[model samples]
Target chain A: MPNINTLWRTYQNLIISAAILLFCAIGFITAVFPAVEKIQSLLSDTQQLTDDTKALTAKLTVLNALDESSLRQQLSAVISAVPTDKSLPTVFSTIEGLAAQSGVSVVSVDIEGDTALATASAAKQTPEEKMLGTRTIPFSATIEGTLDAIQHFIALAPQVRRLLRIRTFAITFPSDAKPVRISLEMDAFYQPSPTSLGKTGAAIVTLSDAEQSVISKVSQLPQVSGADMSLPPPLMGQMKPNPFAP
Target chain B: MSTSEINLLKRSGNTLRTLTDLEDKLRVIAWWSLVALLAAGIILGTAFFYLSSRSDQLQSQSAQLGRQIDAQLVKEGILTSLKQRADVAKNALDAARPWGNLFPILSMIALPTQLKSISIDESAHVRLTMILGSVDDAVTVVTNMIALSGQHTIRAPQLISFVIKADGTVQMGVSFIPTL
Candidate 1:
């Protein structure tokens, strides 16, 4: 029913429509699909980041608590190491007992200074030995005795069930002093204080949520009460920390 | 009509025919739209799967954070009993200590074994295969029954009834109720 030119034009128009539709389909698959995929991945990443933040925060709380515990332990260790002489009277009496055993008359046994101990902390450097510190308290003693008596006294010092060590000793007799009477000056160090026993050390900072949660759980744990940890020759409730280094 | 006019008319006629031919094929647009819809559904489903999985992970992480925060509160003395230091006396009995198991095991060993039983079920019901050997043994067993519960070491048959067996063995089955 159509002329030859009309028929040709009709074919041309149909081809153009097909070409346009095909292009549109290709564009939707290649360009639009990829873009959508990229957006999905970014959204996934955002969710992951949020999760990471929450987890890290919780972890941080646990770490902080552990850190605080460690610090507290350190403080306790330091307090225990501080030298003290609260048991001086007991030590003197023990010395008297030893002197009686040795047949030595102790004319004088006086503390060189006002010495007192707040705690006794012990740290083992090895299974059998410790690097002991009694510097917080220093003492000087004078005794009148013979060579054998002095030796017995020295031996008796360590044997006192609770340790007392002789750090330094000197034997002196003036030019006009009696030959039978020997004068001795000795320095002894006794057990240190456990000052850190009741102390809380510096706290560590935590910024994570997980750390916070763990700390919270630990806080709820039940603990035994009514156990007294006070040491004899008790320290007046006040603990003055060492002055800050200038 | 003039020669040019005839040519124009022919051209218009051809264009109309072509458009008419394409109209039949254009019906396929509905089919393509269906395919597009299916593709969108699949895309949406995949996205939902990924999002749900991510949400789960985030939830777990949040819970962990909450736990950590709880720990912090404990250390800060927000929890009272936990902050209290264990004393030397009770430290020995604390379940946290490895040596605390000694007392419980000792107590178990001290449990009395007066009731005799042939079998015990997982639910702790006793079945007696043999009865009491003597009237005195029966009374003694009953009196001591208070100490029989919670004793896992007693594996022997218990008394169910006072019936005497053909072989002269006494048989009886008894249950423990005082929860000794």
Candidate 2:
């Protein structure tokens, strides 16, 4: 029953107060809540990054303690003994030299092609061989020598620069005084360089004691001379004394 | 007084009473609203303070972690190279079948025996055929060869065949794999 003017006068302050509360609540929801969410997200990211950094630091500490130079030297020596390429001439020369040293006469050297030992060694290829990037090639050599000479040659075969393993041996003793003919079948291995894998950045490596021992043994193999490793100076590039002059 | 004038007076009094009551209710509502606004302000203020403090701490922690990450990255590089080099060396060593122990093993079995021929496969498995003067000599050789299994250099020595010839001579073939 109150007049409109009186009702308006009574509720004006209430309306103003309600409007202010609504504005404040809206401000809190729109501005403050979003900021809190952002801060929470940032904190979570920082915690995760901290954990990752700690793990990386621990790994780095272990890796930093190794003797890098000695490892490189050992690695170099091992790779040289089991070179990546066939280096057939070097292998041929090493076998011929061992034959001469053992006082044996070389009859023929037949370097077995890739297919010769493929059947034998292919089945025996280990998981480690696949991981290390290696393959095997077989070869054979025929020689005539005394029993002592043949024994010495066999003893020294594993010491050569290119890795060799005697697969089969056959001998014929025609007479006690005449030289015995010996047939030797062997396998040689080839490995692609580690760099060939195209891996970049650091990696974790763990070697067993047996693997370490093998590295040490291969490191002891004699270093192949540069002269023995390369083909004789190309005839066209050779420096020779002038035949027409002095 | 006339009846109409009395009714009009009563009606005005009732209207005044209703307005007063409405005014009291409005006062209560206003007080409650003020209290609610004050509580909301305090909550928002506390939230802002807490968020800002946490953000600052996180920023500092992030910076520290970033530095650690950078240092570790450099170390990781060196470690990676060393690991790769070591792996390459190990592979080469594995490929180079160094059977330096073969001779010693053969010498141990050399008792009045004639070693006809010996063969080794790519896996470093050895096969040997020999002739012994007697069954005792053959047994001695077999025992010596079997004893090589104790050495780290050999494994799985198996006597493949043993035949006694009419001339009282024993022929034997043995196969074994090396662990070098």
TM-score of each: 0.28, 0.57
For TM-score, the strongest prediction is 2
Listed for every candidate in order, the interface RMSD values in angstroms are: 18.9, 7.8
lDDT of 1 by residue, B37-151 (tens): 5686577667767776776677676667656654454333311211221111112112111211222322332221222322223233333332445656556555544444335
- For model 1, residues A129-169, the per-residue Cα lDDT tens digits are 22222231234455556545655554554443222444334
Q: Candidate 2 chain B — worst ten consecutive residues by lDDT sum?
A: B73-82
Q: Where does candidate 2 chain A have its weakest 10-residue lDDT segment? A: A230-239
* Candidates' chain B TM-scores in the order shown: 0.30, 0.54
In the order shown, the candidates' DockQ scores are 0.02, 0.17
Report the C-alpha lDDT of model 2 over B1-180, residue by residue, as the tens digit. Answer: 878767342447787788667666766775675676567667766866776676676557556644644444433333343344345555544454545456567777653137766667656778878888889888988878777777654688888999999999898988888665
How many steric overlaps does candidate 2 have?
3
Q: Give residue B169's error in model 1 in angstroms.
A: 99
- State the lDDT at A162 in candidate 2: 62
Q: Give the Å error, residue A84, model 2.
A: 3.7
Clashing pairs in 2: A167-B120, A202-B80, A203-B80
